[model samples]
Target: MSWTERQRALLGAMGLRVWGETAPEHALATSDAGLEDAAAPASPSDPDPAPPRPAAPERRRAPAPQADAASPPPRASPAIDLGAVAAMEWPALREAVAACRACDLCQTRTQTVFGVGHARAHWMVVGEAPGEQEDRQGEPFVGAAGQLLDRMLAALQLSRADDGDAASRVYIANTLKCRPPRNRNPSAEELHACEPFLVRQIELLRPRIILAMGRFAVQALLRSDEPVGKLRGRVHRYQGVPLVVTYHPAYLLRNLPDKARAWEDLCLAAGVAEAAAEAAG
Candidate 1:
């Protein structure tokens, strides 16, 4: 789409340049002038007349064919059954993920990131999907974004890996097991195909608090299309677990100012975890 001044400013904020970019000329045109006017109908009395045509060549028409009753109808393909995957335990679930080919992403992915950290931690960190480093390392959040996430977790006295203490342990996983080609956004079908694995993980862990990072992660978990800015600063729930939305670490890296807002989200999540513990006690 053609970028407006406001859109250009937004792109600048995200550290992007709009100059020399190829975009549709009239993409940002928010007027109906180009559209056909429904109110003004064409009148039969209009002055324009049809032009005369020269002599045309004649051709024979083909006969209509009848349906063949002898031919059998084509059978429909069977749908992928997620029921078996949902019923699997941790080991079986990991195996299922390794062998999962329900989506096209499987063909491009080097390996499925089955997630790391404590299996039954009280806090769960969910990201959108795997990146290049993550896919290569077979772990989620492994690059600069992952480093930022580590610092954030350290600030909260939480560790994705087992730090020899159960209370400080936190589980980290992504919305999709496999990364999309070129790290593009995961399609609706891909998410749908991989959702059972995520759902099963949540069910098995039953984390008291879930921190959803990025717009896609929040959208998948909450089933809402609202932007992360709108969804943040408030606690939501997922399958009875307290869920909080926040900017992804990769987003925070580009928009440094939003890191403060992410910190706020983390604090809110911690509060929820404490309350849950007190209620349990």
Candidate 2:
């Protein structure tokens, strides 16, 4: 998309390079060199990197080995039955998640957090996965991070509960029903195993808009590993629903300044939802 000077400036502020734009030869060379050296591409746009915070005590899972170019393609893992999952009602879906052993996470989790809020809500909030507290409590967002999420939703006049206006209510779920061991990032295999559950959740709820928070949620919905900062300004589609990406509330807790960016994402999502609702009416 062609961007105005003001839009380009905003992209600069967000630490994103406009695609198909030229960069200084020296800078481009340096960036390419650094990317080669780095294990994972560090976020290009974080102005102030947040200090590392130790995760709460939990079991650690071994890292999966990186695949080699010459290695044979791995056989397909068992696929989740999306049809059955989608056909089940809310109560049955919850039961299935609780009993799920499709991945290793289910073995360690205390219980599945089946999601919370109105099933038919207009706005759906998709998070990364369950954490220690969430696994124990059987809720999607809880504790300090959850409180912040509630406040964030309140800012948009949306709530997890159904008490608010029907249009303002939101259903919250995660990319994975069970927490990854020690809160380490979910592996591609695990994400694939659990994806059907989430996809079915979206199909069942049919939210007017989806707010995808954190890297995993955004990646799961968009199938892109782009950083949230670069992804936030654009309106994306997931199963025909508009999606807006933002830093997870947990990340926002550490990088407080990004809350403003998150608010911008929420506003953008609200505008899309408004337009969609109007068109439907």
Candidate 3:
């Protein structure tokens, strides 16, 4: 299919080579652009949480104190009420995330990084976790990496911060609400604690497509430990929602060649979203 002026601009912004009369069709996708090398894991202070992986640098904060195995598990003060959180409206849900102390991260995070975007968007971008910038700003997809993500989404004609058409809008959230301290691997416990908020958010937003970015987010959503390269170019499901997987923008920044692949994933997602919208219509 021919590209639109907007499509050309979107691909241009993402630094993808425009294929004049060389393209096929457009599609949809979602993601969390973090600040780090994609090959190595890095922590972030403002954006999506950097996964605990081999090595790299990001918005690193001092590691949180690890609980002693001999000591009794830390008691969650005012434990999160899963049922209550699931039943909350947007206002109540926001407050629950803000006050949540269900995991050790609550102690280190400056503030909880709740999601942002159109409440009823058809597309949802789910990242790994909160980063330094994300924690401080109380928003996801900030900083340079976020800029890249915006470009990617623009290629698909979507935005997380817009009052544009609902079908063109996006809602971005993270698998983990708070940053996993330093480079420490986020525990299964931490993921379990935060799952409710994301689950409820999905239920509330009822997005048509979900873009899972980063190893952790992909793992959490798809329940797979496969490398992103193996998982790309295919459709997955999260709670029956059509999901597309791609590398985090942070990874793309370091591995420039992958931009083309990311664009392909975006195109795949766009096609899926378009098909879904048509069916619903």
Q: Highest lDDT: which candidate?
A: 3
Task: State the lDDT of candidate 1 residue by residue for 1-281, as single tens digits.
Answer: 24466656554554433422532233222223422221233347845322222222232222332367786522211123456665788899888788676677877889999888887799999999999998999999999999889867766667998556656778899999998999899987777667878889999888988899997887678766667897687666777787888999999999998876777677667667766777789
> Alpha-carbon error at 72 in model 3, in Å?
19
The lDDT of model 2 is: 0.73
Stretches of candidate 3 off by over 4 Å are: 1-75
TM-score of 3: 0.77
What is the Å distance of residue 84 in model 1 from its true position?
1.4
Better of 2 and 3 by lDDT: 3
lDDT of 3 by residue, 111-131 (tens): 888999999899998888877
Q: Candidates 1 and 3: which is better by TM-score? A: 3
Candidate 1, run of 10 with poorest lDDT: 49-58
lDDT per residue for candidate 2 within 1-281, as digits (tens), equals: 25467646654664544433532232222122222211223366856432232222232332343478787633432444555776887788888787676677866788888899987899999999999999999999999999888866665567899566768899999999998889899997788778878888888889998999999997777766668887776566677677778889999889867876776677667666766677779
lDDT of each: 0.73, 0.73, 0.75
In angstroms, the error of model 2 at 3 is: 33
Candidate 2: segments with Cα more than 4 A from true spot: 1-79
TM-score for all predictions? 0.72, 0.72, 0.77
Worst window of 10 by summed lDDT in candidate 3: 28-37
Name the regions of candidate 1 deviating beyond 4 angstroms.
1-80
